[model samples]
Target chain A: MARKLASEDLTPVAGGGLLHRRLFLKAGLVLATAQTATSLRAEEVAATTPRAKPEDPADPSWIHKPGLPFTGYGTPSKYEKHVVRNIGGNRTPQGDGVSWTPLEELEGIVTPSGLHFERHHDGVPDIDPAVHRLVIHGLVQRPLEFTVANLLRYPMRSRFLFIECGGNSNAGWHEEPIQRPAGSFHGLVSCSEWTGVPLSLLLDEAGVDPKASWVIAEGADAGLLNVSLPLSKLMDDAMVGLYQNGERVRPENGYPLRLIVPGWEGITNVKWLRRLHVTDAPAMTRNETAKYTELLPSGKARMFTFVMDAKSLITSPSPGQKMHGANVYEIRGLAWSGRGKISKVEVSADGGKSWAEAELQDPVMSQCFTRFRSPWAWDGKAALLKSRATDETGYVQPERDVLIKERGREGYFHYNAIVCWAVDEDGTISHVYA
Target chain B: MSMLRCVAALMIAVSVASLAVAEEDTRVKGHIDGAHGSAAVEPAASANMRLGTPLTSDDIAKWDRTIFPDGRGLPPGRGSAKEGRVIYEQKCARCHGEHGEGGTSEELVSGPTPPSPDNPSKAIGSYWPYATTIFDFVRRSMPPAAPGSLSADETYAVTAYLLAANAIIPESAEMNAETLAAVRMPNRDGFIWIDVKK
Candidate 1:
């Protein structure tokens, strides 16, 4: 049996609508609602059940003894051990696989460095920064080689961006709805504050030749993973990421150095970056022509389709979560666009029949995750929920049918469609195509 | 009364001197270079900050293993499918299967079947656009356990074996840096680049 929630328990914000609680927006700044929700629930629990003090001359267990000494590094609490990445890999070859970030269990826009999603071709190579060198050659006036110390001296910039796998959310193309947690299906994307030096500064020093158009960025992994990127894009905003969040980048996420192509596909952001060879033509690597290319309905394969389209997913009220006989629940989700910042996200309670504007969290920068929330007053009835995003470029996320019609059914990558979660009268939530 | 007038004049002079000092302090605090006269002073041009070292041709050659579609960067080596069969049976058959049918890893050959929407088999023959990709991928990362361990001749042999098995090349075809690049893949013209306007 589900415990019923009271409508009066949730106090609406002043000057906001009755049903919607704009908890994210306060004085034009976005407040952290995950912290607020935790504190609010704690307060409600304390008010309902007050604990009596111990009667004897004995102190509480935690207070009776001194706490453990602080360490040089900290870890998540023991209670949060369940919040781990779900590893999905090949059986025979241990390294060739992916580990999905548990997006449903995470809060806020930034994905912790430890819990970030991973997609490796060969494996996570143990690279020593001392010997690692990034050589820039090919069509340049002067070919140069930079060590880890040399790259650190160049000017750098930081950005909050999302790196989504080209194959993220590909289960939507299935004939039947995938019966799994939302994160397991769509957690290939993760956001972080990456700091790095721009590739243009190095190109300027090298004196790029006039004929050079494409730059082949390669990694130092066992696979020697390489991808051809446009020189124009690299000069625009591409970075040689040295740090993730604040500290140095983790090994799995490309330690030593990485090529951070903001808003582009994840594969192009070559990890453990070792070399950049500028050329007038593309290398026509296996990944570019055979793998990442999309099989369109017109029988012509779409190659080098880099930019990730606008997509939004309601993390809560998604599959595997129950309504708990909801009275008033805050529906929260993440929206992002590779083209630019997300302008709006609309939540449809009745499955696209009607939609209401959700409040977008403040400081919504371009090519970053924008947290959105909307208050819903459930009457303990069966309902369907969905979310659609619109980017600053005026491109709206398409529905499943529309996407299938455009890309065809045989597509294996880049599936971004509106997802629907059906809430039954029994409070159980399930995936649906409605 | 004349003595008081002298003191007032002295006080006015002191006040004017302090105001001028304060103005000078403000200018200094603002980093205003008096020589430039504050008309958007440009940074002083200094010698180039040569951060990284210049690499010699030999140093560049060691790490530059990239193989372009036009046959550039292929090492000097030659092999045939006959020679590659022995190596494939011993080293690669465990993962890629006995006849390149694929067991644990990717399938290497698909025979005469073309890739379609319903039956998409991305193998060496059906999907790969360039033959140089086979040589490049095999040379760089093959036999996953011991990658980059294969000799240039061994890589060419394996590439020839895979191409021959897929019926794309003759069984006795000799594969080298130039010949491998000249081998036309079946789906070479199958791809079309579409630049979607954001």
Candidate 2:
């Protein structure tokens, strides 16, 4: 008992066969062609989206046999083993590199903690909760230390936020487009619902001295990694994250505790956090002084450039994904902003010639990933796909060329630019600079 | 508690706190000026919970490991680059190379040419803005495999040797708390600190 999808539903909203979002919202409605069938509407949807059907309906093996018993921890289906962290590259100690989240293989906002992208300084330290301690000292009137049990006594709040490495999307700096999967190419970022006590309360209890301008947060990892964070941020929205996605934080993602500085760069969210030294000046740690700092064309480096900025990526129909030849495909993607919420996301199908606003999924939290979707009709011809995001602050994501011109060719960190995917006539898609 | 409740409380807490925080934009620290509405939830009071134990000066001194740029926390010890050469070969040579040009670890020596976009050397001499960081890093996390294993004297020696290798100091010059903190870095003014508004 549903109304037939009108021909107007199949109208192209933009160039390159981009259709209205309502047409492909429901698979049943898209297929339920009534009187419109046998007309031009039928011809328009001739190669409609294909949903899988069994050779003999209701004869699937999974339902006919006895299901296996479940354990305490359940994993994705065996068939989904391909979806995993793309841990690549060679490092000096083999434990110092990053593993990318397979963005193309997942959807929605929260990244599974197990599959969260990881960038470790040395290696994951096996920490004992009983032995782990967080000491708040230096410039405070009374230096205090808290055990895991002590932290549990405090009232906790949770927020969905993203932690993006400053070096993420550096591959975009290459002269030629890196032909990697969207997730592997730009998956060094992930979102999580981190639950913990607001750091302001703890700092208040410890009684912050008036002279302390910055705090040097140190992790308990092998390198004893550290970074300097502005006191304002820690007081505003940062959390001493003890839980990720409702459970105790995964070890690789900072098990016992992680400093969740909301929208700041990942290094500042020191994992396995052990110390917070309030000081009048920054500690000038190696990570703050040399590593996370971005070199500019002016020869002066940009240090403490903390905000991740606004960025968006089309997960499907991007590089490594293929097209079901000449079909009505629903393009899905994600958008987020560090300054505030994402106000809009636009889809360009004809290489930026024309663009249409994408339908944003609900509950678009501030400083968190926002899901976006657009519908497209491919007529077995070459096409280009790109998505651009604008944050609530009216900051639009710049195009690749525009970004390059502003931040020279050499700057590696904070590369938030539009991404383009070129689809060939033969049903293959690859990364493009356009 | 439902997930939505936590989010709702936080959102209200955030809006209220942001308005309260706008006044103290210039100051760095003090008694918590904002974000107090978060505690305004149930329990009406957090000072009553009274978690965490206070530490004496001796207790803080034991765990206070941060090294500041203005000669605040460098431990008492001294070593010359001459004495550090032997320690460097034995403890650091395999990863850092013989001359600090980089082996498996990062390059430590200054560049043969001036820093340019094409040949930007992020070595200790060309990039790091402070000299005390060298001693702090070595003493805390060095050798890659066994961290915090070097003595104060040995770390000072390695810092002196690396400084000498980069031609920032003389091989005979000893590195102590005072002398090491006094050594000025070439790129001390290379970073833009105007973005500290965060």
Candidate 3:
């Protein structure tokens, strides 16, 4: 039973032919917009549109014949093979690079487990859970080591959280606006359902010394990647994740264990977690002091910047896809922040000249992706599109110019600015600085 | 949740010589807080869930090799830049360049000056804040392919060679644990830590 809305409800909420937010809530209200769909050729329409069946519908070949047997596991439909992670700078044998999630083709907030973006320093190691162990030492009352079986005995909590690389959208610092897909440019961050035991329980079991204020975490990969985090953070909300998406984690995603630090950079959520050493001071690892740190125009570098600020991106009608000739289309996108839940997301269709609030989907979780959408009417004219996000902390995503004025064009990390896509008159969408 | 008090019933298998296990925690031995009870672990009951194989110093020495910037974990080894040059050319030069000016790998030495974002030369001499990091990184993961292949003395020699090449130390200086811990790089004071009581 689809709900209907009157055509009179198609009122422009903002400038440049934007529709009311309620258009999304009412079922099939898109049909009431003068019955105008994207102008499709008769051949393309006939191929997909269902044909009327005779009184006695005949069974198709798949139904008439015996079906294929079930396999041990299942995979995505072969037709959807194009949907995959985009690997960049791939040097295979001596692994070092990253992969981007194709955000434009995805819908809703939850990213599929297989499509989660990956960044490897020395490639994913094949760890046999039978022999792997997590050791807790340094400033503790007793040094204890636990095998995978031991951790599973502890109580577990599940949460939908996000882990964003500190350098996720750093390309925005380019003097010229980078012309790439939304995900390729800003897909280093990903969200998922993680189930694990609270780290405080384990830390308490180890009995942390009064002198310890920092915890150095290291992975089991070839690089032995390490970083120092504030002790309070691990006790507050960090967990040693044992499961992802209700199943044993994949090898590339820390099969045995991963430190899921909510609202922090991805590197701090150390994967293939092998050791935790409590101390009084930070180790000042290479990642912290040399790489992740940002150099400012002031001739100084900003280090230990753990929290990612508010950011949003309009995914649909973005680069790489051609728009249908002059019709109403839904402008949808994703919004998130490391501080807390996203409070609001405002969309603009005229180069940020006029704005309207997009409807946020339900279950707007903290430190998780929030999907937002708004109905847009295009009259076959050129237009600029953008989305701005505001987290619960009252921090709004800054404009490109505003961010540049404060941080400067020299910054190579932590770039979160309003993204704009120019819709050309020919229905071709492209990335633009406007 | 008194994790310390709950230890009144567990026995740790540790000799008197081991400082790794606190003396007070090894007093008792018995069953862990009802592993047979309902699996739903409430915080009150699970506080007593002290589990894991108590590790002795010998059991962890092989894996506990990460060195601190203050040289807390530096092994008892020493090496000089003159000895390091031979090791550098044979093992490190092909990737890091003959002069450590960077070829296929990161630049290890460069002129000491402030690094601007445009000319962001994050070479060791310009950006790295600690001299001990060269030893720490080289020993932990270097040569990009086979990590942990260098012995402690070789790592110290490479550290000495790089430091001398960067003009931070004398070419003839033999670096030991105490000396390496005290060697300050040019940008040692350039770091600023926030959000903690550093």
Q: Find the candidate with the highest DockQ and give its number.
A: 2
Report lDDT (Cα) of residue B87, candidate 3: 91
What C-alpha lDDT do the candidate models reach, one value each?
0.82, 0.82, 0.80
Where does candidate 1 stray beyond 4 Å? A1-60, B1-47, B196-198
User: Could you tell me every candidate's TM-score relative to the true structure?
Assistant: 0.84, 0.87, 0.87
Residue B17 lDDT, candidate 2, scale 0-100: 68
- Which of candidates 2 and 3 reaches a greater lDDT? 2
- TM-score of B chain for each model? 0.72, 0.73, 0.71
Q: Residues A1-434, candidate 3, lDDT per residue (tens digit)?
A: 46665576567788777777667677455531211112223346667888785233575546667877887688887756767888985653357788888887688887888988888888898999989999998889888898888787676778898778887878888877777778889888878899987888889888899998999999998878888899999989899999988887778888899999888888899999999988888877787877787777776777778888889999887876667768778888999998999999999989999998999998899999999988887777998999999999999999999998887776577888999999899877788887
Model 2, total clashes: 0
RMSD of each: 11.5, 10.2, 8.5
True contacts kept of each: 0.53, 0.59, 0.41
Q: Between candidates 1 and 3, name the one with more favorable DockQ.
A: 3
Model 3 residue A93 CA deviation in Å:
6.4
CAPRI-wise, candidate 3 is: acceptable
Candidate 2 regions with alpha-carbon error over 4 angstroms? A1-5, A25-57, B1-47, B112-114
lDDT of 3 by residue, B47-107 (tens): 4667767788887786686678898888999999998999999888887889998876668
Best candidate according to lDDT = 2
Deviation (Å) of A342 in candidate 1: 0.5
lDDT, candidate 2, at A180: 89
DockQ of 3: 0.26
By lDDT, the candidates rank as 2, 1, 3
